[model samples]
Target chain A: MASNIPEKYKTLIKNNKRIDGRTLDELRPVKIKVGVIPSADGSAYIEIGNTKVLAAVHGPKEMFPRHMINEDRAVLNVRYAMLPFSTSERVRPGPSRRSNEISKVTRHALESVIFLEEYPGMGIDLTLDIIQADAGTRATAITAASVALAHAGIPMKGLVAATAIGKINDRLAVDLNGPEDNFGQTDMPIAMISTNKNITLLQMDGDFSKEEFKTALSMAKKAIEPLFEAQRAALQKYYK
Target chain B: MTLLYQNMQYIRNNIAKNREDGRTSEQFRDITIETGIIGRAEGSARVKIGDTEIIAGVKMEIGTPFPDSPGEGIIMVNSEFSALASPDFENGPPREDSIELSRVVDRGIRESKTVDVEKLCIEKGSKVWMVFVDITIVNHDGNLIDAAGIGAITALLTAQIPTINEDGTLNREEFVGSLPIKEIPVPITSGLINNTIITDMTKDETECSDAIFTVTTIENENYCAMQKAGPSEMTEKQMLDIANIAQKESKKIRSAIKATVKKHKI
Candidate 1:
């Protein structure tokens, strides 16, 4: 019934292109700043196009209350918080189902690359707070979390990065912005470890052909390469 | 209610200046309104009064009309005050502050008959348009009632109604016209501090006040809504003064709204 509703959005993001003039397979310009918070062991501020998020890591410490210890490996704690003034519509300050789900999946995405055995029975806390949101928040949260973990000197095989591939007007587009994500038919967010190209996170909704899925996955793999480079450069810049 | 002896003394001594910042008792804080800021809503505006900020959005939908008012559309007002705005505010369902704000805003719009609901009726007694106005407090310096009211009305004034298809389905991408608003309602709030009445109370001023008064006017002369809050007593003369000041101040705010609509070409 709302099929005719997204025509403006479709015209804005024509086939193989986005509203901001980027090609379908291209990623948004990402900037990452490491060690932004001196209070946290590790912290990173990241911006993917217009979306901005901050991640902080505090870890390898005894689990609070004592009984929640894992005994086998360090526990990963993830939290996603959006500032009340982050989006155009003020969001109530608290964790909603969306944030809870993002926090859980974000932990899973980073868990695959983290060397948890190095800090047995300790706690590793990661907080991803959104300062400004345009779209693709979960993907940027994972990207910043991975960078914050590396900055914290946590043991990890490789840094992780994420991006979204969405279908708009029957076209596969990478890094959907706010309007595109809202109007588009399908949205898929993917997270991967850059070193070995292992897909640690994958999620999608809406219509997609088998061919579209393969093309989107390959595009995500290639899109994360430059993101991986940006991650390393952020840490390197801080060290210097 | 927190009228400490020292603060009370300060307010008495500063009576000549109207406030610590030297604004006249009837003067309002700086007003700034930016429309169409929310991408998801049909109509949206972010308004700021000095340091206090609020955002308002209007969402339109089609639903069955009320049994008695089948030909008239519905307008629902709601508000939120998150902890981010102030430590005193909690995150949950609507609190007393939010409910009061919404009710006051809603009363003014309803009493003024701003939107011509009869025009909103898509089908005589079965289908009608519903307009929802949501106001969110971003910063709580003070006078949230006025800030939210302005935000809501501004958003509504700028809101566009989507085109209805032949089958009555809404075409979200294409908006046909602005909501059928009949009039503009502007609100001004005043508070009593140290026995003196003040307009546009700041957070500090509101914290120590005994009574608060708000008046909403339409076309600069008609009273649409009025509210009195807090535990302090209000003299008959004080209430009359509030009404007078509100009537005078509303003209300026209404002009501002008109300028905004003109600038936005809505």
Candidate 2:
């Protein structure tokens, strides 16, 4: 079967370079801002490469419909929408099949750090809107959402940051762009609480040797330093 | 919704004149249509009618032809009534309302022969194309059928099938061509409240409606599908009037679809 691996990418990989002219460990520029939406309890905006995401944290308030309510711990609900104008072709407005599954994982990622027991019978809602998407939009949204949650003054274990690292044309590259994501051999989008060294979220597809996986994970680990700093800076900027 | 229900007499009087939001009984809500929005999908559009927003996405994959139609491609429509869109919606599997909505829209497109399904065939029965059109409700104000129908048709019109790899995976990076289409179908809906007929009911207005009807026409030339809901009965004259109005209203909607699709041609 012909994989998405194009000859140009493979050729570039052989030369120890990437299509975007970055070294193996190089990253795209990242911008993060907190408290973008005044109506929400807390909000954030982030841009990773061409992917732009906005996240709002709504209430650690009452969980409704009776059944979803938890007596001992607050629930987390994450809804990720790729806006119709967010891509080259318009996405339909509602959640696709992947949307629900991603919500579950995103909830788990945020749940680990949140002091859910403090707000029993309530739900913290996170809404992520991808205003412009390239690839790895979910990770970018999670990174921004974490910042928004912190800005809301929700107690937490630590702030989180998300990024993806993968192999493109046999070259392990940090932060795959739209094209790289389509053609890369393997991709792992992950979330980590910066201080605990714990992997809060992990999912991977495509082929990766054990050695390659370790390298990708470690590369992701290193990328967090900058992402965590950006998150902190955004929060600090909001306070100042 | 209780606000409209609580003032039942006012709703009856309002629909007899202008709607609650002041649109004439025959007028539709303000609509903004744009196409080519989702990058990963074959075709996509975002449509907003008043406060009701919906997204339509079309994606194509190669699959076996259904047993009954070995020579034709398949088109499937799925509507998701998101819980976040409205307080009434739920967050799990599709509810009966969404299922009915999808089926009605699917029948309109299929019966109108909007897409030339035969052209989608790759091989006799071994391989053919399947088009998935998903309409997701972003915000539910009311009159979801019309909004979803508009979204479905616009996305399909703008969709392009992805190039197939030699061994049959897809080249997500490139396109083969636009899906084969013959015509576009536009759906128009009307509701009755306090014996007064109204078009495009908002969630609040829906509470006061006694009967609801939806009709879809193709290029203003023919009726392709129609559906009626509510506990009330419609007089023959009322149904005829609805048919006429829906057909006439479809003209404006079809032109909008064409212009939007034309503006963002692949």
Instruction: List model 2 lDDT by residue over A1-240, tens digit each.
Output: 123345665454546667777777777789988888999998999999899999999999888656989889888888888999988777888877556556656776777688899999998889999899999988898899999999888998888888888767667888888878876665667777877656666555544443555566677879878999999988888899
**Tens digits of per-residue lDDT for model 2, B227-255:** 66553444434555676788788899899
Residue pairs in clash, model 2: A89-B37, A89-B38, A90-B36, A90-B37, A90-B38, A91-B37, A91-B38, A93-B55
Q: lDDT by residue for model 1 over B1-266, one digit each (tens)? A: 33576986787667656587788887788999999898778898899999999999999999988765767888999888978998778799775557767877887787677888888888878888999999999998988988888888899998999888988788877898899987888878998877788899887788867667777888837565666565333444566677778878888988998898778754
What is the TM-score of each candidate's chain B when compared with the real chain B? Answer: 0.93, 0.97
Ten contiguous residues minimizing lDDT sum, candidate 2 chain A:
A1-10
- Residue B14 CA error for candidate 2 (Å)? 2.7
Model 2 regions lying over 4 Å from their true place: A1-240, B1-4
